[model samples]
Target: MNLGVLKDRIFGTAPTVALIVCAVMATDYLVNIVLLNTPNAYTPVSTLLIALVVAAPLSYWLTSQRQRLERLRDDLSASLDAKQEAIEEADRRRGEAEEAERLYRLLSDNLTDHVALWSPKGERVYSSPSIQRITGYTLDEFMALPPQAMVSEADFARVQKLIRGLTPGGPPATADYECTRKDGTLIWLESAYSLLGDGSGILLVTSRDITERKQLELDIAKALELAETASAAKSDFLANMTHELRTPLTAIIGFAEVLRRSRGLSQTAARQVGHILDASNTLLSVVNDVLDFSRLEAGGLELDPAPFDPAAMASSCAALVEERAVAKGLVIKVKASKGLRPMNLDGPRLSQVLLNFLSNAVKFTAHGSITVALSQKVEGDAALLRGAVTDTGIGIAPEHLDNIFDRFSQADAAVSRRFGGTGLGLAISRRIVERMEGQIGVDSVEGRGSTFWFEVRGPLAELAAPEEEAAPLLDGEGGVRLLLVEDNAVNRELIKTMLEPFGVDVETANDGVAGVEAMRQGHFDLVLMDVQMPVMDGLTATREIRAMEGARGAATPIVAMTANVLPEQIANCLAAGMDDHLGKPINPTKLLETVARWSGRTHTA
Candidate 1:
C-alpha cells in the first residue's frame, strides 16, 4: 500500500481517538504537578501511578486503530491492482484480434478466387473484388444485382434448383455451373458453399474458373467421336476392298495355273493369259493402294530405305506402264541426266510413286506422248535427283487441285465414274513421298496436260559393283525349313506358292500358337509371322519364339508380315525380336529375295 493512502486511512478513522489520547497525556502531567503541591495531604506516588495507567491504555487503543486502517489500505490497493492488470490484458487481446481480422479481410478482398458471403435468406451480404475478374462485373454491380444474373441462360435453371435445395443446418454442398461474362462469353465455375454458424445468418462461397478444363473435355469427346467414325469407315472399306481384291486375284491365279498345267496352249492364248495376269496385278495394286491410303489416314504406314540407282528405278517404273502406252498408240520416252547420282531411297515406295504417276498419265492420255524423266539438280551443296512423269491428258480444274490429295476425292464425280478408281492413289503417293522427306506436286491446265514431279536428296557417291552371282532359287541345301504363319487362307497359299518356286521348303501355321508350336517341334531356319491373328498375335509369337530359341541354344530369324505396316508397328515388331518386316500382300520377288538373304544365299535375278 502507498504511504499517502495509509496516512489518509489512519486520519480518517476518527478524531475522537486522537483527542482521547491528548486528554489522557495532559491529565497525567497535571496530576503529577498537583501531587507535588499536596505532598503532605496524600501519597503523591499513587496519583502519579494512576495518571500513567490512564495514558497507557489510551495510547494502546490509538496504536491498534492506526494498524487496522493500514491493513484495510493494503487490501484496497491489491484489489485496484488486479482490476487494472485484467483491463490491460483484455485491451492487448482486442488489438491482436483486430489485427487478425484486418489481415483476413485484406486477403479475402485480394485473392484471385471468387469469395462471397450470402445471407441465409439468400441475399448478397458481401463479395470480393475478384468477382470482377471472373464475371466481368464490378463488385458493387454484383452486390446490387441478383447472383443469378451471372449464370448462363442454359445453366440458370439447374443452378436455381441446386441453390434452393441447400439447407442452412446441413453440411456444405458443391455445384458446377456455367456463367456468362460481360463480353457474352461463357465460362464454367465450380463452387463450394457452406453455412456460417453466427445467428446473423451468413453462408460462405468460394468459386474457381474451369473454362480450360471444360474445353479440354469437349475436345476429347470430339476426338473420340472422330476416331469411332474413322474406325467404322475403315471396316467398311476393308470389306469392300477384300471383295475387290479377290475377284482379280482369282482370275489371275486361275489363268496362271491353267497356263502352267497346259502344254498344248497356243502362243496367242498364252499371250492373253499373260495380259490377264498383268491386268490382275494392276487391279490388285489398286486394291493395295486403297488399303494403304486407309492405313495412312489411320497413321499406319512405314518405309524401308536402301541404296538404288535412280535411273534404273525410273526405267523399271516406266517399263510397267509402257505396254499400256503403246496399246494406246502413244509414244513413250525416258530421259536421264548425265552422271545421275545414285540415292538411298525406299526403292519399292519410290517405284510405287513412279508407277502411280505413270499409270495415271497412261490412263488419262488418249493419243499424246508420255515422258518419264530422271535428272539430277544441284540444290546448294546437296545433289537432288528429280523424277517427273508428264503427259498430254485431261488435267485438273484449278479449284479441285488442292483437294486431289485428300483420300477418296477425285477431280470430280464424273471422273471417278469414268475412270473407275478408288481415288486414293494420289493421296497415298503424297503421303509416301512425304514420309521419305521428299516433295510431290502437279502442274496442269484444264484442257492441256499434266506434269507430276518428285525429288529426293542423297549422297552423289558412286555405287560399288555387285559381287559374284548365285543361283536364281533360294538355298534349301542346308536342310532349313521355314514356318509361314498366316491367318488368311488366301494369303497363306499365295505366300506358299511364291516361296515354293524359290525352292524354299515351306511349312504353314494358321495362327500364332501353331507358329510357336512349329518352331518348337522343328529345326526351322526362319519364321514368317503375320501380325493380326486369332488367339495370339504375331508380335507375341515372335517374342515367344525368341525366348525358345535362347533356351534351345539356337537362333532362328523371324520376319513380320503385317497389313498395317506403320512405323510404330514396325518399331514394335523389331523391339519384339523380329529380324525384319514385309507388308502384305507379299511381292513374290521381294519375298524370294528376303528368303535368299536370310538363308545364307546370295540372290540373283
Candidate 2:
C-alpha cells in the first residue's frame, strides 16, 4: 500500500538495466578493435546476443539480492519502533506504580488507627507508622517483636484463634480489649480484623483508642447511682418530716375542733378558738402544699381517675372558699353549666386546682365578686371540661404573670408579704393539670381583675350512684370496742376524745408491740393502728395480729391511722393486712365515720 515501496520496485531494475547496456557497448567495442582491427567489422546481432546472455544473469542475481536486503532493512526498522514503544510503556507503568506507593504511604503515615499486615505464618510483615503513636513502638520494632510480646497471653491466644478461624472472603470481625501502652498506662482499644483476598491467608487488623469513651461511660454510671441514692434519701427524709409535722397538727387541730364545738364559752374565748383553728388550718395547708410540690418535683404524683360530676365538683370547690370570701365581704358566684354529665377524671386533684384558683381570688380581691365558671364540650370521643375562676382583684403585673405558677415565686416580695402564702398552690395546680393532659393559664389587667383557668379532657362516664355518707355511731346498740395504737400520747388522747362521744369503748396501746398484745388478749371490733412507732411499726403490728388470728378466728378490721399519707404508704398499709387507711391531721368527722362503718355499732349507757 506504500507508494514509496511501489516507486522503489519500479526504479530498482533501472541500475541493472544501465549496467547491462554499458557492458554490451564495451564488449562490442572490444570485438571490433581486436578481430578485424576495424570498428566497422562488428556484427550487431551476435554482439548484442552475447552481451545480453551474460548481463541478464548478473542483473537477475544482483537485483534479487538487493531486494532481499531491502526487505531485511524494513523488518529491522519495524522491530526498532516496536521496541521503543515497549520501553515507553514500561516507564509509564513504573511511574504510576511509584505514585501509588507514595499515596499509600501518605495515608498510612497520617491515619490515627494503627494498621498492620500479617503473613500466613503469623509474622507481622508490615506495620504503619501510626503503630508508634498507638502502641509506642516504631514500625520496624513493632514488626520485629513477637506477637506474644505485644499483647497479653490471653489476648494472644484469642487473636490466634480468631485468625485461624478466618476465611479470606468472609466479613470482618471486631472486638474490644483492655491493653497497656508502652508507658504502662492502661487503655481500651476497639479493633477490627479482616483477612486479605487472593488465596493468601494474610490478615489486616485496625485498632483505635476508646479510653476516653470508656471512662465517660463509667463516670455516667457512677453519677446515676449517686443520683438515685440521693433521691431515695430525700424521699425518706420527706416521709419522716411529714410524719413529724402532721402528728402535731393532728393534736392541734383535733383539740381546737373539740374546743370550738364545746358549749358555754365567752365570746372572746370563742373568737380566740376560731383564730387558733384558722391558723392551724393555714399551717396544715402550707405543709400539704410543700409535700404536694415535692411529690410533683420527684415525678411521683399520680392521678386516680373516677366518675364525678364536673359541675358539682366546681360548686364544692367554690363552697370550700366561700366562708373566707364572705368574711372578706366578697360575693362568690358559681356559674357551672347544667347537665354536665359525670366524667372519668381525678376529682380530688381537679378540685385541688379549682380550690387554688378560688382561694387566690378571695385572697387578692378586696370588694369585688369571685365567679367560678365550669363548662364542657364534646371533642371527638373526649369531653373537654374547662373551669375558670374570674375575680375583680388587685391584678398581677405583666412581668409577674409569666412566672406566677413558678414554685416559691410571687409577684415581687411585696406581694408575698402582703398575701401570706407558700407560693406553691399555683405551681402544684399547674403540675396536676398538665399531668391530666390539660392546659392552664391566666388573663389579667393591672389593678382591675384576674382570671385563672384550666382545660382538661376526659371521656364521658356513667355517674356512680352517690355513696351514703358513713354515719356516726348511733345510740341504743352494743358497746363497740376499739383499740387505738399510737406512739404519741397527745395523738392517742386526741383520737380517743374524737371517738368516745359516740358511746364507743376505746382502749389504748402505747406502741405496736402493746397493740399486738392487746389484740391477742381480747377481741375488738376494730383496731386503729398508727404507723412509725417504737418496738414495731403499724404494718408489722398488723401482720403480727393477722398471724395470731390465723384461719379460724374472724379478721378484725385494722385501719391505718398514720401521718404517712403518701400513696405508696397507703398501699403498704393495705398490703400489710389493714382494711383501710386514715391520714392525719385526723378529720374528726371522718374518724367517727370510719369507726361507725367498721364497728357497726355504738354503746348505750
lDDT winner: 2
Tens-place lDDT digits, model 1, residues 327-375: 8998888998888767666778889888889988988888889999988
Candidate 2: RMSD over Cα atoms?
4.7
- TM-score quality measure for candidate 2: 0.84
lDDT by candidate, in order shown: 0.76, 0.87
Task: Please provide, for model 2 over 459-566, each residue's C-alpha lDDT reduced to its tens digit, 9 standing for 90 to 100.
Answer: 889886777856545443637888999999998888878777767788999999999999889988889999999989899999988888875456888889999998
- Runs in model 2 deviating more than 4 A are 1-75, 118-125, 138-173, 197-201, 466-479, 543-555, 575-577, 596-605
Output the lDDT of residue 225, model 2.
Answer: 91
List TM-scores for all candidates, in order: 0.56, 0.84
